[model samples]
Target: MGHRGFKSSQTQRGLAMVELVITLPLLLLLLFTFGEFGRMLFQYNSLMQASRDAGRFVAGQAWNATLGKVDLSATLQSQTKSVAVYGIPANPNGYPAVVPGLTTGNVSVAAVGTDHVQVSITYTFVPVIGSALPAFYGQSVPLGLALTSTVVMRAL
Candidate 1:
C-alpha cells in the first residue's frame, strides 16, 4: 500500500538509443543543407560585386576625341580581370577565391554601345557538404553549380 507506480522493464533500456540512432542523421542532414545554401549565396554575391566594379570602371571612361567612341585600353581590360578575380587591380596573388574554379580568364569585358560597357564573370560552386554524405542518402547530388554575373553601365 505504500507505492502503486508501475515499474519499467530492462527491455526499455535501448529505446532511447534506438530513437537517437534513427533521428540523428536526419537532423544533421537538415543542418548541413542550410549551411550549404548560405555558402552558395555568399559566393554569388562576391561575383556580382566584382563584375559591377569592373563595369563601373569601364563605363566611366570618356569618349575619344579622334576615335569618336569610348576607347578602351588593353591596360584597362587587364586591370578589370585582375580586379574581378583577386578583388584588387594591383594584387598579383589571389586572396582566397570565393568560388572554387574562378579565374581571371573567366571575366569578360565588352563594349555594348557607344557609351555602355559590360562586364561578365563566371564561377563554379561546389558544395563541401553535399558530396560528403552520399552513403547516408540514396541519391547523388550535382557536382557543382555554375554561376554568372553581368553588369552593364552607361558612361558618365
Candidate 2:
C-alpha cells in the first residue's frame, strides 16, 4: 500500500508549478523573439513590394517635357511616394498600422543614368523584445535596424 500519511499526489502537487517557474521566462522570451523577427521580415517584404510598385510606375511612365526644363519628375516623385506608402493615390498617414514611422520622406525615386528609374525605401525597425533581451552581434539588439529596399527598371 502507498504511504498512509502522505499521498503520492500531494508530493507532486507543485511539480508543474516549479517547472513553469523555471521555463516560463524562457518560453516567453522565445515567443517574443520570434514574433519580433517575424514582424521585421513582414515589414521588409512590404517595403520591397512597395518599392517594386513604384518602380513599375516610374518605368512605364512617359516623360513630360511640357514645361521646358521643369519636366514631370517632381510630379512623378509625388505619385510614387503616394503609391508606395498607401498603395493608392493618397493616404496622408502613410502605410496602414503595420509599419510605424513610415512617411513620404522615407521613399526616394531617382533617375539612374538615362533609361533606368530606381525606387528606394528606408525604414528603422525598433524591436519590442530586443530591449528586454541581451545584446548580440556586438551591439544592443534593441537598437533600431535600418532596413532598405531598392527596385530599378528601365524606362519605357
Candidate 3:
C-alpha cells in the first residue's frame, strides 16, 4: 500500500507540471493580444478626433478679401495646433508638424465654391511578442499591420 501511494503522488505531480506547461503559453499569448487590440482602438479614436477638428476649422472660416494674398494653409495649421490636434501628418511644405503616429495629405481649397479639405492618418501596429513567431517558420513569412483613416468637410 505504501508503494502504491508513492506512485500515485508522483503521477499527480507529473500531470500538474504538464498542465502548467500547456497553459502558460496560452495565458501569455492572450495577454499580448489584448494589449495590441487596445492600442489599435486608442489610435483609431485619436485619428477620428483630429479629422473632425480639421473639418470644423475649415467650415468656420471666411473667404479672404485680399487678391492674390489668400493663405488658408496658415489658418488651418493654426487651428489644428490650437485644438491640440494629433495623429495627422504634416504637409510636405512643412506648414504643420506631423503627428507621431500618422500622416496627412490631399488638402485643397476653392475660390468661388465651397472650401474642401481632407485629413488622413495612418498607423502601423505590431504585436508585443508575436514578432518572434516567424523564426519558427524558418523565416518564411513577415508580419506587419497598418491602419488608415480619412475625413472631409466643406465650408459653410
Candidate 4:
C-alpha cells in the first residue's frame, strides 16, 4: 500500500517519466555528436579523394619523356587547383566545390623531388553546432579545424 490507499505501482507511475526527462538530453547530445563526427569524416574523405584526383591529373600532365623530369607549368598549376575544387580542369560557372568552403586558393600543386607531383589541399571544417565556441576565459574559441590532405604520385 502507498499514498492515498493506492498500490506502490500507482505511486511510482511518474518514475519512468522523471528518468526519461533526465536522460533524454544526454542521449540526444550523444546522437548529435556521432552525427557530426560522421559528417566530418565524410568531408575529409571527399577532400582526400579530390587531392588524389588532382595529383593523378598533374602527374600525367607534368611528366615529359624527353626531359625525363616533371615540369609543372603555371597553366598546369591553375588547372590542378581547379581540378581539386571542381574535379575538372576547367571551373564551370555555378559549380559547387567538392567540400564546403573549398577554393582554388586552398589547393597547391608542386613538383616533388623532380620526379613526383604533389597535390595538397587545405580546408577548414566548420561544425554544425557553430563556427566558434565560448570559452570560460571570456575568449572565443574557433571550432573550425584545419584539415590538410596531400597526395604524391610518381610522374609518368
In the order shown, the candidates' Cα RMSDs to the true structure are 3.8, 5.0, 6.4, 2.8
Model 1 lDDT tens row, 9-61: 76578898999999999999999989989989998999998888777776766
Instruction: Summarize candidate 4's per-residue lDDT along 37-136 as a digit string, tens digits.
Output: 8999999999999999999899889998888889888999999999999999997686899998899999999888979999999999999989998988
Q: What's the residue-level lDDT of 150 in candidate 1?
A: 97
Which residues of candidate 2, in runs, are more than 4 Å off? 1-13, 62-72, 92-98, 129-141
For candidate 1, the TM-score is: 0.79
C-alpha RMSD (angstroms) for model 2: 5.0
Compared with the true structure, what per-residue lDDT tens digits does model 2 show for residues 78-103? Answer: 98877787786566664473256788
For model 1, name the residue pairs that clash: none
lDDT of each: 0.78, 0.77, 0.54, 0.92
| Structural similarity to truth (TM-score) of each candidate | 0.79, 0.74, 0.60, 0.90
Cα-lDDT of candidate 1 = 0.78
Give candidate 1's error at residue 122 in angstroms: 0.8
Segments in model 4 whose C-alpha atoms lie over 4 Å from true places: 1-7
* Weakest lDDT window of 10 consecutive positions for candidate 3: 103-112
> Taking the tens digit of each residue's C-alpha lDDT, what string does model 3 give over 79-154?
4444324323333444443334343332232233335555454556555554435455467454556656566665
- The prediction achieving the highest TM-score against the true structure is 4
Ranking by TM-score: 4, 1, 2, 3
lDDT of 4: 0.92
The order by descending lDDT is 4, 1, 2, 3
Clashing pairs in 2: none
For candidate 1, give the lDDT of residue 54: 74
